[model samples]
Target: MNLFADIRLAVIAALDALVAEGGLPAGLDYANVAVEPPRDALHGDMATNAAMVLAKPAGAKPRDIAEALAAKLGADARIMAAEVAGPGFLNLRLAPGVWADVVRAALKAGAGYGRSSLGKGVKVNVEYVSANPTGPMHVGHTRGAVFGDALASLLDFAGYEVTREYYINDGGAQVNVLARSAYERYREANGLEPEIREGLYPGDYLIPVGEALKAKYGESLLGQPEEVWLADLREFATEAMMGMIREDLALLNVKMDVYSSEKALYGTGKIEAALKRLEDLGLIYEGVLEPPKGKLPEDWEEREQTLFRSSQFGDDVDRPVKKSDGSWTYFAPDIAYHFDKVERGFDQLIDVFGADHGGYVKRMKAAVAALSENRVPLDIKLIQLVKLFKNGEPFKMSKRAGTFVTLRDVVEQAGADVTRFHMLTRKNDAPLDFDFDKVLEQSKDNPVFYVQYAHARVASVLRKAAEAGVDVSDAALGAADLSLNTHPAELELARKIAEWPRHVEIAARANEPHRIAFFLYEIASDLHALWNRGNEEPALRFVQDDAAITSAKIAQARACAVVISAGLGILGVTPAEEMR
Candidate 1:
């Protein structure tokens, strides 16, 4: 029931008819032809660029082709009028019955109304929030978590087989630092004043991990050397940190389908195998990298290293896989991890990283390209920072996290639904300001509140109709005679509802879940505008004196609610039946 898509097909069919009638030459590629909502709603319900796109290709004037295409499209019963606008743009006004059918379709489908098959069930692995297994997730990781989870849900709605994954950074030197920090805490738990060192993690979240360590290893590890206890404590502490991270994610209602370990690639043949695949293609070699372009580091030296020829595959330079010290660089395990992803047979891969990792994008894509021989596509989305404010002032750091705000702190204050919705209010690459006071305020300025209020208002309408003895079930509403919904306000809301499936496809194709939030806000604005109009004209009220009229109006409101619920479901936010 995508009216926009249906109209595009009609326009294409009309162009084909023109070719058949010998009015236009054959083979005028129609791929660029599009039927979309008019820029100005007052102009028409939909607009098409078939004439403008085909004019030059067909060796015809724009207006001439537009007039011919308009005449051909006017024959369709769904299109009430097709008027040529500026320079060959065809604006279309759809029949009222067409809008009525869109409402009926929404009511019939309920939560499944806007689901799309854009991906055709292609397997996509979405790796996100792969923060170091050292401490609780911070505000930065929270944004990535929300964005990734919503993206996974959006892909699922768009018919992609999505796997939500987290890659644990346990093999890095950071985890060894975590081990030393936890050992100090273990000594603290054993009634000794622990050394609060500078390099070790200082968060109180790991104090429990230290206590747990004492419970497991007891005082036997208290006086041992680093070798005797470091490895065991590193494994134990990482597991505890991961457990805490899982709980933090749960607080925001985020869950992962897989958890990959960086440590698992160490001492395994996976890294060697991934590099071997690149080496076989003559992409791996030992060479000296040129000095960096900008200000060179004080200790900068042009030393020979094992490098991957990433420059051939779009990276700025060949990236090193191993350092001069004969140890794997950070890029080595990453290449192996992505190679593992490609080997798992996923058709596509998506990684959600913080904006600081922007420089790593090209190199990572190059690695995946080399590993999959360009067969698998990798899309990396970098989420920017989130600045928090309380009462218009900068929010303070979390005491539990020691220096930064924890995900749990934000969730506990703003709630999971509000936090998730607000996090997506801005584009992923754009910095976001999370104002605690503004987000929770129950005003139209707040998008989350406005959208939720729309759903709640619809529920109120249904309840009032039901109490008045009007049948308000979806089956009844969908079957209602909606011809009475001829008011401009009512019709406009239906127009917005018809755009749901089209918007879903657009957002999913761009891999931008933030678009869904914007769409929801627009639809909610329309719904609120219509609801407020009813106060000025009692006849426009949903619960009319006549049962048939009330049923029709209720049906329209229910359809809007249906789309809102579906959009919220994709965002992992529960729709409110009644806002408290």
Candidate 2:
């Protein structure tokens, strides 16, 4: 039960009653009316803007409307008090029983407590970490992978039919680079000094590909021309690299529903068909673009080329689809790829891109808009960079990836769970500092362990209660006398628990999974606060002298565990049963 929503409904009903009593207009729009937690906890349990929002529309004074609405709301049993505040804001204090009911609801709902249906079964395709299929995923792609996977899980929990996807960049020059790099490995495997040239991937991760090439063809491909062996090696090397990427993603507990290849769109008429569709709509034409504003390239020329009128749909300027040499530009295949997604009948599309791709956002949205005729909406989320630190110093780079760190290196050092949770400690757009020493610290300063410690403490309490001959199973704890939970600290936790459903809808609507991590941290703080208070006042402890009291208190502790488990589940991190 969403107590906040229930209270909003009550406030709306009171406004309707005021209209019936001739205190307000009958037809004032109430869409802007909202009920949320008060900015200050001392204000009240919840606050509503019904009076302030309706005053002008209903042709009534703000305070007058607020007083009338407060009187009507205060008459309800669940509302202990409703006071009209500055300029018609209405603050409400809920009956203590409302919090008790929330605790019981949490126990009954377990892991399903905060699941929402806000998405309403809409099909959303989330494409992320579509890195070039040339090597194993590095630290840059790791952030996208974690963010996308968590978002997919969040949307799924919030009732969206989500498909996790990866678009492979196999049709670009990058694949040809992979082929040449593997050929060197092939020669190296055949006992010859390989030319590890410039402009090609130099990571040792591809050593296996060279070894595999040697096994497949031996010395036959040693003296062949580029044409004779490039095709087979390109296909073979891309598959192997993708395999390694899949393993990297799986290391972080991520799996894509589909892996689309740009190569698959080549020579299949898909690109031509997509451009033709745009051409039929008068969006495609041969034109010359203005030189970039700041600095023009030395070879810049105003040459005629096939272009898409991206500015028609909100891009800064028209963009070239085909170069002057008649070859498809990078944007051409991306347009075709998105067109293929739209044709697959997806109602919505979400692309999670790195912050460097910020320039591509508008043009991509324009492409989807023109292709789908604005029927399908695309949301692009840009994930910023993650800086790593260890022992109060910046984490150094890896020689293997040449200039950057690899995902496996981070995971192997900081561990997957710590890495996942710490990456989400900040919003996607904000910079996050992953300090290896700070994250693993056992103190409350570390959010990951703090949250996990809360769950582990709950398990400890359950074990202690069971050993004391008290029944602590879910069924028994759920049936306990929850009315005994009247302490302010105990009731405050229940109030936080009641906010879960509200938090889920907010995070999902904003497409920010980082909100879940923040909420979990707050919940864990409340749980830990109560645990520490038990030391000062023994009555606040989960295990008590009497069986009835123990059951009631332990039930609340278990309820906290239940919510934490559900939140961690959405984050794809296993909730700890006990701290090692």
Candidate 3:
């Protein structure tokens, strides 16, 4: 079903035959050989570097090997022509029937069309949206949530056993600040003046948490010392914030397989155990770190601390695990968390962090490398900022969140599908601008609407054909004489459909789900182009005077929908059945 893959296999077989016939030397590695769309479409459908890569290894001139490989490939029924280009590159043009077969394959596969087995069912843990348990998720967290959720789904579609996880930052000082803020709100709920002081959360969202706290504890803990109530209220507020975060994620239809608490890492000996493993590996040492490279902090001093030899693996410098005061540094728990993931036997670990965490990437990677002894691979994706705009101006801040725009605000205004799709229009590490009016516009320039419109157009085609008494069922369309689809425009769309499976594997292999959005936009562009052509070209219409031809044409449109729907599913967007 993967046309490019099939063609690559044919090319490999041709090379194998060349080796067998003694036309080429024996024992040449073909692993570096690749077949892909040419940089310029006019060059050919696909271009392979099989000869270019093997010429030196096989001890033959590039031209001679390319000519030999060309002859073998030209004999393939699937390849219409195989010609050698400059420096021994072979350009291949597939037989026209191959594109027709792509339509049949898409129709036969339905929603499973682009699903790939690229990951080989390896266990992958994707941890994202681990926003501090302080308040509602903001727009920044929204981007991370959407990106990570889509990536996990993409990996799963590519046959990875993906686990969506959220690591709660409750053990940090932020949670302590949250407890004090909630305590103030709890006082306000108990009919007293609340101190919404500096360095405290002032979001109106905490008012409800205050009411809940009052209901649970009444006035019994009023006026208690910070020591008496800090721990209890910290736990309480963290849970309350997590409840709101869960609701926020649900608004976007994101559900996690696991929720890990950083506070739990304390008192569980897990952090100590992780460090012990590092110590056993000789990666842990007690020493004074050199003063950091840049401007010295006001409290900077060279003090003895427990450090991890992170630089040995690939970090800017060694990282501290414990402070001079014997308290675990922030890096300690993160290492333990990742160690827990490794111990759980996940084949790979992916951390979705904000752009601000870029500096932590190397050290985190070094830790996982040392702890897992390089058995587990760690990939940390840094999600960049999402700037919000309405019309042409910056969107106002969320009063509920007290500073930034809340995830709920964005989702409620634009709806989940629009928000998710628009968020992915750019790379994860690139900044994105979410303009409410632009994304909801019913224009082809808007990818969200454009892609959805393609699916809806296919739906419209099916409805029209069905009303005209054409057998538009998948079985009937798949059984249609697809060879009747002879129009160049129609076959071009089929060719695009054929690229879906290949693009899925490519996107999944790169761990970049945004590429799926990019591919969806491209294929949608092809569908829209063909749909427009139908307006002036009657023969290109989906519903024709002849029911059989109508079935044939509608098969192509349905095939378009099949790949579009499958792609949108990976992005967690519902394929629109009709355009509004």
Model 1 error, position 270 (Å): 0.5
Residue-level lDDT tens digits of model 1 in 1-580? 7888889999989999999999999998989999899889999999998888888889999899999999998899999999999998999999999999999999998889988878998999999999999999999999999999999999999999999999999999999999999999999999999997899888998889888888887899988999999999999999999999999999989999999999999998999999999999999999999999999999998899999999999999999999999999999999999999999999999999999999999999999998999999999999999999998899999888988999999999999999999999999999999999999999999999999999999999888888878889999999999999999999999999999999999999889999999999999999899888999999898888888898999999999999999999999999999989
Which residue window of length 10 is worst by lDDT in model 1? 209-218
The TM-score obtained by model 1 is 0.99
lDDT, model 3: 0.92
Error of 3 at 180 (Å): 0.6
What's the distance in Å from true for residue 59, model 2? 2.1
Q: What's the lDDT for residue 79 in model 1?
A: 92
Cα RMSD of predicted structure 1: 1.0
Q: Given candidate 3, what's the lDDT at residue 61? A: 90
- TM-score for all models, in order of appearance: 0.99, 0.98, 0.99
Shift in Å, residue 433, candidate 2:
1.5
Q: Score candidate 2 by lDDT.
A: 0.91
Provide C-alpha RMSD values for all models, in order.
Answer: 1.0, 1.3, 1.0
lDDT for model 1 comes to: 0.94
Off by over 4 Å in 3: none
lDDT of each: 0.94, 0.91, 0.92
Candidate 3 colliding pairs: none
